[model samples]
Target: MSALSSSVQAVTALWNRMPFVGRVASQLTVVNIFDCATRLAAQAFLSAIPVLFVIGAFAPQAVRDQLVESLRTVMGLGGATLDQVQGVLTADSGNVKDASGAVGVLVTLASATACSRALQRVCERSWHMRSAGLKVVMWRWVAWLVVLLVALIAQGALHDAFGAGALLGIPVSLVASVMLWWWTQHLLLGGRVRWLPLLPGALITGIAVVALTWGSRLYVPRTLERSVDQFGPLGAVFTLLSWLIVFFACITVGIALGYVVAHEQPFDRWLRTSAATGRTDPADDADLAEESAQRP
Candidate 1:
């Protein structure tokens, strides 16, 4: 028993001595990142899907076409699989078909804020910050949702900008993704965290998005077709939900990683150094040193 106890202590001591690994392990202990991702994905499926249905049913034809094309380009959808997704989105359920006026659309968009709330929790947990009150962030939720839809709708053009090879498109997409996620973190966090600290996570998310975009373009279409062929429409649902889970997982992990990267060792010093040197914005001063002292 003594020998076993000693061995365990020694191992724990070794792990504790390794700074980088310890920080990562600490972050993981602090946040169940994969679980957060799963919840975000599921929430998006439940909340965002209805909004998509509403948009498909009522949005202008040009907007609808752009949305569909964006989906096609991003997910590499075509043929039966694409048709299945379209059918689901455009389904004439009496409530949705009967839905008219801005009231219904606004309600659907409001429901979609559940996703925003989920994402907000993700950012809060990742950064080890207290939650922002709904009153403070209520409009942010809707605004973020609107921005998200616009970004998605514009995805096809972004991807095809360099003649579909995405040679130049990839870099452009990376920058756009970084900017979007950076703003998203700031917006969702109610600007509690400095932009510089947020940049690492945004960059991580941007790279993840670019990689996943290419991965989906390469892997999703054929796999989706096969799944649909084998299990009917339900297969598409499973496949997409699976994809969403992975996508959200990457995002959650990226945020957590960004936190780890930003706060750990030399990077944290750099942020402090930047602040001291006046390179960062004056607004960053108040919160700049806050995260450094809170490292796990």
Candidate 2:
């Protein structure tokens, strides 16, 4: 492990000396962001299916339309893709639907809960950090659900306050989005990273998320068109999966870039370097303990 770290440090030190693009390229190779993203996206999408079904049962037309439009903006779902999603979600059939929906909800919730745990593990792998204990499990859920609540409330507040004023609305929305993203990162990875070091990545992620949300209008429709032709209703599923993959990839890159920029030392100071908080890297802590054992 020490040898591998030494090699990575040596390569990273050299790679760091290169231009920004070169460093990013090297780090991207090191992180396996795409593989991690694919797993996250697939897991999330599969687990969301039954939740969508339950949501379909109670959500009003106006609510569903708003959601559909948001999906179009974020994942390019419209036309047949949009119709298919609603059909699957709102397959109403009285008691049969209720019974089946209840079962589906339980199964999907369990899957989503497991996948959320996997997501934490993936973050640890990507950032090369410590495993969390069962003690943190409840706190993690609290933090995550709190962020989701904040996001929803913020969206509603913004719309209610600025529904008529486009000139005043855009900046407010942007600010809200940025704040939401930052808070989300803080909650998601707070124990592993400090606030100061986490900001850059969170900001990058926020901007990327906004860009994706806006740009979905341009690309999502065409993608959805192709997806439907290729796989019928499943096309919406796959298209949504594709969007999720890119979204997670953006998140991984943001975290990595923040770490690269925040925690790395200059080449000249590498040997004597300490991290921002003057703490040993968690990755090296175990090895240091083991080495201490051998010395005595």
Candidate 3:
């Protein structure tokens, strides 16, 4: 009976610690914007190549021709004939699509390369120190890639089945987004901490990510449309900037949230410390530095 009581108390203590962890994560997220942005940009750029290639290869020839024509019109090259545009599109599309099969290989290599870089960036931004080695970093990236692919495929299937506007589809997407965020949290913090112990933080970060994603989908496109309507061509640039900022911000926040939840540290304390000292906690710093020091 005494042992059972102790076990129940231990569980209660852990449960009580979660909210504090979540708050810290949110605070840290706001503080580490630049670090998160650089890593995210690298990941985005690497991922985009494969995505574009897949789109170019799989999309119908007619669609590609239309896209090129639209670009020509946008560029005010009215004299640029459809045949010229079509020829260029055909050549480019072939090159892009022909590489589709290689995308997985490329993505794997790119993620491995980026993981070390990302770890370094995160450590430097959050903490003052760096770590080295690619083994754990590569594994983390691979894990994230697997989870991302699963989420994307599931989301795509849900969209196909119910359409995005359906009531059921909305909840399904929300759940999936949360899962993606949870998996991402797991990937990022898994090295220093056990996955099971970090469940609360992962869950909290996942919920926040889902909320942000849904909110952004509603607001961002409309905001872009309005800006374009008001500012003409220049609005397009602004729209792109807006999207990048929002995306980077959300990613940073999500990461911070996950970290806080897993560590149970106060967000403001870390944020202030990171800024004043220009360094994060030693534990967080160690993994990245270790990964970077590893030989290729």
Determine which window of 10 residues in candidate 1 has minimal summed lDDT. 273-282
Winner on TM-score (1 vs 2):
1
Q: Please estimate how well model 3 matches the true structure, expressed as its whole-model Cα lDDT.
A: 0.50
Who is ahead in TM-score, 2 or 3? Answer: 2
| Candidate 1 lDDT over residue span 1-296, tens digit each | 99999999999999978878887776765567777778878888887567777877766767777888888988788888667567756666455667645687777887788888888877876776666777889999999999999999888888877466668888878888889998998899887777788888899998998789878987998888889899988888898888899899888888878887886678878765244221344354335334432422
The RMSD of every model to the true structure, in order and in angstroms, is 6.0, 7.8, 12.7
**Model 2: per-residue lDDT, tens digit, 1-296?**
99999999999898777767685665565556786678778767776666566556655655555555455444656787677776865566365356756677556556556555545554444444555566765467445643543454345334334465644545665677667655655555546554565566666766776666657768888887888898887886777788889988877777667555554555213422133223446667455434422321
Relative to the unseen true structure, what is the C-alpha lDDT of residue 78 in candidate 2, on a scale of 0 to 100?
Answer: 75
- Report the C-alpha displacement of residue 121, candidate 1, in angstroms: 0.5
- Candidate 3 lDDT tens digits, 52-154: 3454565677556445433332222222233444544466655655554676656645654464356334533333234334665657665665555444334
Query: lDDT of each structure?
Result: 0.78, 0.60, 0.50
Ranking by TM-score: 1, 2, 3
Spell out the clash pairs found in candidate 1.
none
Residue 235 of model 1 has an lDDT of 86
The per-candidate count of clashes, in order, stands at 0, 0, 19
